[model samples]
Target: MTDQLDDLIATVQEQERRLVLTRFTHDDAWALGSLVVGLARERGLPVTVDVTRGAQQLFHAALEGTAAHNDVWIARKVATVRELGTSSFLAGLQARARGEVFEDAPWIDATRMAGHGGAFPITVEGAGVVGTLTVSGLPQADDHALAVEALELFRAG
Candidate 1:
């Protein structure tokens, strides 16, 4: 990995570590989901962010739409907690580099797939992928933009 990738990963990992130790709620699913969806739309991407755990609560409805409510379907396991060192995340980076969208592409095996609606693992050098950053319910270019924007924010902070 390049020096810049290393540095960016380090910074993002530090932030994730802080959030974990502090039990921060700001980075929770609802909050992060809103940010991802809003940013994607701001970038002119059609977006729908499903919490994948939320029931059809009023709050859930207000957050995005009925799809945001996690109760309607067999909720995929929530993976909000940061996981920078996992093989799952590592594969995501490699897949992205190959010009393939792993999560949304159904051709990949179930075990190898990213479970979230469409998450792009944010990866950096030594730190690896810090978390699942996603932007979907849109065109490929728009989806990529959402992840890119999230990575930019991660790097900035």
Candidate 2:
């Protein structure tokens, strides 16, 4: 389990290093959000997608079968990304690798932050992580994958 966790951490770190945006704007957020929404629709996924730049929420959508609680999850996951400057998934994996629970960390407030997968940093080339892209309502890994897939597609286009 430790080795697997370490491998996963490496993969997530590589993803964070590779999936960077040149710049993030309100229009870019809409485009990225639309891509995520379309991907979810194609897969018949019930999820909520959110994009934020710093403290500003640029785009948000709740798909079919998703509940309001998904937004709460989004908030917590986004907080994780904001605090860690990495994918929320990576934060969880790092904690596991250290034999610690993420929420048990002294600096984390469980109510406002979560290390669950789903939130990814929206990193710009020069500005570092300017925002976050998040999804919720599926299993943590799946939610993280969905966000990563959308980002890959958006980056490719």
Candidate 3:
């Protein structure tokens, strides 16, 4: 389990390093959010997607079959990314790798910060992580994968 966590950590770190944008804008948010929605629809995934820069939301969508609770999850995941400046999944993995519970940390509020997968930092070249692209409604790992896949597609174009 430790080895697997370590491997995942490494992979996530690599993703953070490589999946960087030259810049992020409202148009980029729309494109990325649409890509995620398209992919989710293709897979029949019931999910909510959100993109935000600081306190400003750029784009948001909730697919069919998703519930209000999914938005709650999105908020939590986004908060996790905002606070940690890393992928929420990576934060969870790093905590587990250290045999620590992330939410148990004094600075963490379990209700508003989820260490689960699905929220990814929107990193810009030379600007660092300026926002988050988040998804919810699927299993945590799948949600994370969907977000990553969309980011990869957006980066490729």
State each model's C-alpha RMSD to the native: 8.3, 0.8, 0.8
Task: Tell me, by lDDT, which candidate is best.
Answer: 2
Candidate 3's C-alpha runs over 4 A off are none
Better of 1 and 3 by TM-score: 3
Q: Supply the TM-score for candidate 1.
A: 0.39
Reference-based lDDT, residue 55, model 3: 78
Candidate 1, overall lDDT? Answer: 0.40
- Candidate 1 wrongly placed segments (more than 4 Å): 1-29, 50-118, 122-131, 154-157
For model 2 the local lDDT of residue 50 reads 99
The sequence of per-residue lDDT tens digits that candidate 3 reaches over residues 10-105 is 998998888999999999999999999999899899999999987799999999999999999899889999988999999888888888988887
- Worst-scoring 10-residue span by lDDT in model 3: 98-107
Which rank order by TM-score, best down to worst? Answer: 2, 3, 1
User: Global CA lDDT of candidate 3, please?
Assistant: 0.91
RMSD of 2: 0.8
* Alpha-carbon deviation at 147 in model 2, angstroms: 0.8
